[model samples]
Target: MSQLTGPVPDTVFPRLGWVDDLVVPALREAVGALPAAEARVAGYHRGWTEADGAPVESTPRRGKAVRPALTLLSALAVGGSARDALPGAVAVELVHDFTLLHDDVIDGDALRRHRPAAWSVFGTSAAVLAGDALLVAAMRAVSDVPCRSAAAVAELVGALMELVEGQSADVAFEEAPAVSVPQYLGMAGGKTGSLMGCACALGGVLAGADGERVGGLREFGRRLGVAFQCADDVLGIWGRSRRSGKPVGSDLAARKKSLPVVAALAGEGAAARELRALYASPHPLAEQEVVVARELVERAGGREAAEEEARRQLAEALRALSYARPSADVYRQLQEIAWAMVRRDA
Candidate 1:
C-alpha cells in the first residue's frame, strides 16, 4: 500500500533494467530498419529524435515502458533469460506505439506527453503509415523469435483484433444515448487489458512454462490492465491537465462515455439526470459545462466507484500474480509496479 503518487520509482519492476538496456535498444534497431521516410516519422514519434532528424532529448517522447517491462519481467519470473524474450518484448512495445500513433488521430488529440501528437507533427497520413509500419514490424519481430514464434504471433494477432474492436466500441459509445457499466468495462478490458495479457502470455510461453502458469501470468496482466484504464478515467477528469499532458476534462468535452461518465449517467439520482441532459445536448460541451460535468460525476459517486474498481482490479491482479508463484523478489516487484500503475497521479 505504498503511495505511488510522485516521481517514478527507480525500479518500476525488477526487469525494467533489462527493458532499458535490451528492449529499447532493440526497438531502436527495428525502427532504424524502416524505410527512410517511415523511419524518420517513427523515430520522431518515439521521442528518440526530432521531426527534422535533429538529435534532441525529449523524455516525453519515450513513454513509460510498462508493456515491454512486463514482457521482460514475466520472462525472468518464469526462469527465462530476458535476452530470450527480447523479441517478444520488442513486439509488445511496437504494438503499443502503433496503437498510440493511430489512436491519437482517431481521438483527434493534438498533443501527447505535452508535445504535439505524431499526426500533428508529421501529418496524419505519415503518422498513420508509420503506425502501419510498426504493426508489421511487431509481427515480424515476434515471428522471428527462435522458440514458440507461431504461438507468440497468434497471441499478438488476437490482441490487436481486440484492440480494434475496443476502439470501435469507444467511438460508437460517444454517439449512443446510453452505455451500460458492463459494456464500458468490456471496452476497457478490450482496449487496455488484451495486449497486457498477451504480453505476459507471450513471455511465459517463450519461457517454456506450463499452460497453467502462462494462464496465471496472463490473468495477472489482464486485471492490472483493467485497473490501469480505470485509473486513467480518474485522471481524464480530475488529474492535472499539465501534469497529464492533456486538457482538463478532455474526455468530458468530447462526451467520451468513459467509465466515470458512463457510471454517472447510469446512476439513479438528480445528478445523473442533470448529467444526461448535459450530454444529450447536440453541441459539444463548453468549458463551463465540462467543469459541471466533472462535479456531477463526482456527486453521483462515479469517481469513488471508479476508484474502488481500480483498487479491486489491482487486488485481483495481485492474486493472479500470486497464482503464478513467482520468486519472492519478482513477486514483490510486480506487486509494487501494479500498485504504482493504479495509484499514479498522472
Candidate 2:
C-alpha cells in the first residue's frame, strides 16, 4: 500500500482523489458480480451509467465518498498503510450506498445525488433487491480481508444492526407526538454514527492497532458522525439560504424529526409553540408553510441548539482522537476532517 499524500494540502477535499482511485475501481469490480438486471440499477445509482446500462459519456454522478476517506485515514492514523485498509473502505462505501437506496424508498424521495433515485428509475422492488445485493457484496468484500477478517466482519455486522434500528426509530418518530433530544441523538447514533465508527475501527483493525486504540478510533468516528448529522440537518435547512435567505429542503418538506426541528420543538419560546402546533396539524404543510417552519425553527432557537450540539460533538470527537494517541500529523489530518464534517456548505 502506497501513501497517497505526504500531508493535507490546500485542497478542501483531502484524499478524495485517492478514494476515487482505490475505492471506485474496487466498487466497480464488486458491482460487476451482480446479475445484469441488478447490476444495471446499481450502476445507475452509482452514476456510472445510464438507466439502460450504457456507459456515461459525461461526468459520472457521485457522492462525497467520505466514509472511505475516514477508513483510509484511520489506517494511517494507527500507523498502517492506506492501501492496507482498502477492503474496509470498500465495505463501508457499499454499506453507505445500501442505506441510501433503502432510505430513498422509505422517505419517498424521488431524487438522489440530484437526479432520479434508483427506486424511481427501476421499480421499488428492483431498487430494493439491488440494495440488498449491495449489502451482501459489502459483507463479502470485507470477509476476505487478510487482516483480522473475523473482527472486521463483526464490526460491519454490528454497524448494520445499528443502522436498521436507527432507521426504524426514525420512521416511528414521524408519527410520535414528542421526540426527546436524547432519543433523537440515539437515533442518529444508530442511523449514522455506527457506520462511521465501524469505518474507523475497521481501519484500526487492519492496521493491527490494539483493542484500546481501536475502541478510541471507533468512539472518535461515532461522535464525529453525530456532529456530521447535526451539521447536515442544519445545512438541509439553511445552507442554500446563507446566500438566498430562504431555508429549504426535503427534510423540512417531509417534517422529518431532524436534530434542528426536535431541538426547536423542545424550546419554550412562542416560536416553538407555533412550531408545535404546525407540526401537530393533520394537513401537510404547503410550500409557503415550509418557509414559515424554517423561520420558526430559527426563531425558536432550534437552529442555534443544533449548531451548539454540533460543536459539542466535534469537541468530543477530538477528545476521543486524543485518546487514540495518533502521530501529530495524523491528529491534524483527523481533526481537519472532523471539522470539515461540520463546516461543509453542501
Candidate 3:
C-alpha cells in the first residue's frame, strides 16, 4: 500500500534511449498507411456528419505503443529490420486498441489515456463498431505483408482467440463468488500475455528465426506479460491516489478479483472475514474501509507475495531471453524492456 515515487529501479538491463527515435516512426508510418481504411469505418458510425465536422486531428496521441514496440524490437533482436516487421507491429497495436475500445465500454470506464473513452464519446454502439473496424483493419494490414507465411497467420489468429477468452474470464470473475490466485494468473496470461507472446513470435517468424529460438522469444513475452499485470495490480491499489486518476482501492470499490484481494481472501484470517463482510455490506466502502482493505492486503502478505510473483516471472523472462540467440546488444535491449515492464511506475 506504499506510494511509489521517483524513477523506477534498474535491475537486469540498461535502458535504451534510442527506441523513441528508431521504433516509433515506423509504428506511426504503419498506422498512417491505414488512414483511408479508418476513415471508411468512421463514416459507418457518423456518416456525412463526420466528414463535415472538423477532422479528428491525427494527433500523435495514443497510449504508450509498448506492445507494438515490443513486436518491432523482437523482430529486430532476431535480425529483422523494423520496417520489415511494421505490418505485424501495426496488427498487434490495432488489436490492442480494439480491445481497449470494447473493454472501456464493458467496464464503464469513462477515460482512457487521459481522454474520453471512445465508447463514452461515440456511444456504445458506435464504439463497438469502431472496435470491429480496428480488428478488420488489423487483419487487412497483416495480410498485406507480402509473402507472409501460413505459420505466422496461424499465430496471429491464435493470439486473437486467447485475447477474447481472457477478456471473457475477466468479466466473469466480477460476479463469481471466489477467484483463486492461479485463476487470476491464467486470466491475465490469456488476456495480456497471449498478445505479447504473439508480438514476439511474429517478430521471430518474420525474421525466419529457428522454431526453438522463436519459442524462447514467445516465453520471454509471456513471462514479461505476467510480470506486467502483477505490477499493474499493485498500482491499481497503492499507486498515487491523484495520479492514478481513480479512487484509492478503486479495485475494491469495483469488486475486482485482483491477485492481492484473492490471496487475502484465501488465507481465512481476520482480513478475509473483514473483506467478506465489507463486500457483503450494502454501504459503499468509506475511507476507513479503504484503510482496512490496505491493511488486510498487507497483513496477509498479499503485497509481498505479488511482488515476489512478479520477480519470479521476470526471472523466467530473462531466462528465456538468454536462450533466444539474439545478438548480444539486441538481447540486452530486449531484456531491458522486460525489466522496464516490471519496474514502470504507470
Worst ten in a row by lDDT for model 1: 1-10
Q: What is the lDDT of residue 311 in candidate 1?
A: 83
Q: In candidate 3, which residue pairs clash? A: none
lDDT of 1 by residue, 190-296 (tens): 89998898888778878878888888899998889999898888888887643336776788998888788888999999999999899899888899999999999
Candidate No. with top TM-score: 1
lDDT for position 288 in model 3: 74
State every prediction's TM-score relative to the real structure.
0.94, 0.93, 0.84
Name the better of 1 and 3 by TM-score: 1
Which sequence of candidate numbers ranks them by lDDT, best first? 2, 1, 3
Output the lDDT of residue 169, model 2.
Answer: 96
Q: Give the alpha carbon lDDT tens digit for every residue of 181-237 in model 3.
A: 899889989988899988888888777788888898888888888888877777777
lDDT, candidate 2, 159-206, per-residue tens:
999999999999999999999999999999999899999999998988
Clashes of 2: 0
Give the number of the best model, judged by lDDT.
Answer: 2
- Any runs in candidate 2 off by more than 4 Å, and if so which? 1-10, 60-63, 241-247
Using lDDT as the yardstick, the better of models 2 and 3 is 2
Q: What is the lDDT of candidate 2?
A: 0.84
Task: Give the worst 10-residue stretch by lDDT in candidate 2.
Answer: 1-10
